[model samples]
Target: MILYYALLIIDPSLIGIFINPFIVQFTIFTRVYFIACLLGVLIPGILFAIRSIKSDKPEINLQGKLLLIAFISFTIGALLTSSIPQMTIKVIARLILVTSSLEFYMGYLLPNWVKKILLKNDN
Candidate 1:
């Protein structure tokens, strides 16, 4: 991942940039990066989440659900932002991306307040 970012920094055009609302272009590098993300990040995350969800512990199940939502939302947001040219769609996609971060944090950290709310329902 570090090496990939380094290459991106060396050549910014590898990912291509939006010049206008109606114009969108993606370079081969961008496709490769997308595929790398899917394989390296999303797939592992989903597998972990599923395993966690299958555990008997309620806390683990909640965490797994949160992680699953986070990964799915992140993928959707990334896909929308990359493919869609409209400004409104971009804004919505950014919001989804932000929510995914929050979900991931909650899943990883399992804050006490969130645990109380979510796990309480199991009783």
Candidate 2:
């Protein structure tokens, strides 16, 4: 998704050619770009929640919690965007920061605890 966004930025003219009628002005492209970015951020939250639900292991519940946090943060950021000028940049920055933090937590912090729990359960 990020790669797609990059492509859009690099060649807006090429992209516009595919969907020419919809993108009359630069503002429309900007709006579409932002919307795509928002959806890209959202996909992981939804996927994580679904994975958490499907997995029987109770230890996998962290994904659901992260999803909730993501949703709440997104709502708050959206509200702030409406009230503040130049909020899109702030919101995007916040999203990236939060996403990276969550990825780190999942990659590093969760692994040790998950291993410990699985090992304990095995015994």
Best by TM-score: 1
lDDT per residue (tens digit) for residues 1-123 in model 2: 565567678886533343233223334555466566667766776676667746666556654555555554664564344323454555675675576566546533467764564334644
User: What CA root-mean-square deviation does each model show from the true structure?
Assistant: 3.3, 8.8
Worst 10 residues of 2 by lDDT: 18-27
Candidate 2 pairs with clashing backbones: none
Top lDDT hit: 1
After superposition, candidate 2 runs with Cα above 4 Å error:
1-26, 71-83, 86-100, 107-123
Task: Please provide, for model 1 over 15-122, each residue's C-alpha lDDT reduced to its tens digit, 9 standing for 90 to 100.
Answer: 676687555677777777786776678899999999999999988999999999999999989888877778899899999999999999999999999988778763
lDDT of 1: 0.86
Give candidate 2's error at residue 14 in angstroms.
15
Candidate 1 positional error at 35, Å: 3.1
